[model samples]
Target: MDSSAGHTPEPGSPDEPVVVLGVVAAPGQAIGLARKLVEADLTDHIQTTFPGARWQLELLEAGVVQPPAGDAEIVDATRDLLLEHEWDLVLCLTDLPLHVGKRPVVAHANAVHGVAVLSVPALGATGVRQRARGIITGLVGQLLGADADDLREHQKSPARSALRHRVRQLGTDVDEAGTAFTARVLTGNLRLLTGMVRANRPWRLALGLSRALTGAIAAGVFALVTADIWLLADTFGGIRLTGVALGSIIAITATLIIGADLWERGSSRQTREQVALFNIVTVITVVLGVAAFYAALFVLSAIGALCLVVPQVFGATLDHPAGFTDYLEVAWLTCSLATVGGALGAGLETDEAVRDAAYTQHPAEPI
Candidate 1:
């Protein structure tokens, strides 16, 4: 289960290997600590194999609580062996805070590598998720550059594994990862390497398209109400209309939006500033949309004054059929419907929207 030792020298480092030493100073971040060093292409400071460039890897592990003997003493013991073995670089991985302090080990590593040490902090839960996503996306973009379909093949290869350890930290139950695993395997056959970039477009366009379609439908509904109601009022008895359902719809719409925002933000989100900002932005969008539409509707209603009233029992003379009341009613109704419609679209097609929102900025900086 500990694929830890499997990274042993292949065909064995006969002549000399690029030496790497990893110290999983923290308890939980060992998995990431391991790969961050070995997967150089995933994270840092290693030369990719090119013309006349050979990369042979050698890795060692130690612990923060009990480092492998004194730094000076170990370096001394290994100095002769390293010269004999010919190591190009010596890498030390640790998560201990003191390791970065004006400590001696870091100084020693600096002396060895000719520059300051290259280090990655202990990836806590949040860091783990972000780093893992970065690795996957980076790998998807860089090596084995495949479309959506080729992901499985990429996964099976070294390119896919560029960030596997960090990915393992996502805490997806091993059981649930089964589906993801299978999906990856099948992905190689479709959406070839080039397709991932094409498929993973941003949220604005997708959401904008959906919004336009829904807006067209809502407009259709509003037009029907106007035509039917106007004809009925002229034929029978015309009554000034107050949309009775407006308030109830507003309350329902608000509840759904606030509830969904709460759920998405999660209990870990304690700061209210961000939520308030989002709400303010959303309210502004709604107000603008409503105000524009209602103003236009009111103008049309003023034009409606030219028509005759039918079934004249309800003698309500009007300066305009569409009054301030109609503007208020339409504005309220438009916002409620828009909110509900937006929420439904977001919830129903969550896979796409969520993926888009999360990955809007492509390829996070690696480690």
Candidate 2:
């Protein structure tokens, strides 16, 4: 692929000593972060720490290439990017959750090659743009020949703590492969999980399931008009209603996972652990998607019940005075029933469609 085929290059002076930094990022969140890096003008920030040379950013979106699995592979890919572009240094950002041994890797830098690979998900779900900017600045500073201590001292107060705490540099051997930075153990895993889910963007799953939403709305509307449903809603206790809600959500979540074959099955030990991590991320993504659907159904159901069902008629049927709680109960029951209908409707969707909607990117491994 041509290095400068699509993206516009950041403007800079050719006469000045310019350091062109090429940013190759995986599609989705990683690409967005890369764009933000350009908009933020990290070159200006880098100048504050390293000083002297003008810096320019060149971005390449790498959606077609599969994410590199290991540090060596990542370095190789960065080197390839460097060869393709006239970049003084390269940074490859991927949404993939990278692991070095048992720990989650945040980023890796090779001074000799003038390249770095950053795992975006390891930065977690919140304040991603800020964290990315900070980390990138530090890594770019390092690539520009600024020592860690000098970079640390020059970094803004806000980003200093983040650089110190979030990134722990490892591997002392001064080889071409360079040093690895990893997140702390317990908090790192938590961040990885949340970050993976954020990358998946569970809300999109609801938007993708058009057939399911139709079925859910149909069921919810039918339940709203049914006298039996109204009576049951009035009589069922809060605990019973809660149980029903939980059951329906679980049923739908499981249905999508099973029906679409989203569950990962791996053979080797390392692969198994990776599979488990993917599975957990999948489950959480589905659950959140289902829950969002349920919430929408409940809101619509409640409105329908309030507008369609007369208060006096509902009171007469239940043999008690109708109140706001009655409307809520009706909505709650309708949501539960609608969810089950949605699960049934989910069967109409193709496995590929579900998989595409549910994942940020397809893994190189089989799902």
Candidate 3:
């Protein structure tokens, strides 16, 4: 066997057969190779000139290779045919630069039947596809030995494994970007992405992010609800006031980001979109929150209860500074449960995130 440029021709044995799996570069590649070997019997082809398209078609018209039927996606058809065709060996002639190794055939043969594979730079359709089939079978058989590792363990091998690991890292990078953006505003846990980060990070970023998001959300909601009935249109309880909830949300975000930055310098994020969205949601949440309380009153008032606050959108001022101060105090209290106000009024209830995160798994894991 000349393993230099290629394998030597097999000695003729009518009874014994060679099992081959082919991987051609594309549809044209497969067609050309099959034509060369079949119609033209041009068995000795190594590399050919960039001959005109006429030369390309002469082979296809010769019926040496097969083209897929109408309306079928090429890659899928290849797999279906490969799996359906029963033979000692599988020959793949791909015109597309796709993978035979990626096929279920290869996976089944190696992972199940313990086959292995052989690879060589393709010369013709038959040889290239044959070698791919052989190599896959060979690998499967080798891995199927007594000390065999499961597909998962074997996949951790250095050469191929790094690619897998890098893909996972890329996924994590996207996730990290998302978390950082979300943490600065609105309310949603970023823990979804933290699982794939290196250990200990899951604790710091995931847990911390969840808290910040919840605080921001709570503050936004409180602001939206209370701002309407706050006091007088722009005033609080009809008196001038500071924006307490807004301040609390900002304080929490700043403190969290700053703390993280102090510990893991330059690692924290500040995104304007996130902050802007948070602000918008805060404005809306305040309106909704106030309305919601009124709604609660309207519903309870039906049953006769004291939960009713005035349902009016505007009213006489209590006094600008005092009203504003009161609103600010409410905002501040909205952001802090364990800090300023008692635990009942601030942040989100515990059940919200726990309920959402239920059954959620790390995105990178394989089925």
Q: Which candidate ranks first by TM-score, i.e. highest?
A: 2
Candidate 1, which segments miss by more than 4 Å at Cα? 1-216, 223-347, 351-359, 365-367
Candidate 3 runs further than 4 Å off: 1-246, 258-263, 266-306, 310-364
Q: How close is candidate 1 to the true structure, as a TM-score?
A: 0.26
In model 1, the worst 10-residue window by lDDT is 165-174
Q: What digit string (tens of lDDT, one per residue) describes model 3 on residues 1-367?
A: 0011232222243321222222222344445545445344222221011110111111112121244421112322332333333211222333322223233122222111112221122333455544443343333222222112323443455234322222122112112345554453233212212211211122222232355344444543443355443443243432322344344334433343233221111122222222233233323323233223323322322222112222233123333333333433444333332221111232332432321211111111111
Estimate candidate 3's alpha-carbon lDDT, on a 0 to 1 scale: 0.28
User: Which RMSD does model 1 reach against the true structure?
Assistant: 20.9
In terms of lDDT, the best-performing candidate is 2
For candidate 2, the C-alpha RMSD (Å) to the true structure equals 15.7
Cα lDDT tens digits, model 2, 237-315, are 8999999999999988987999987775544322222334456678888999888888888888888888999999999
Q: Please report the TM-score between candidate 2 and the true structure.
A: 0.52
Candidate 2 stretches with Cα past 4 Å from truth are: 1-188, 361-367
- Please give the clash total of every predicted structure, in order: 12, 0, 56
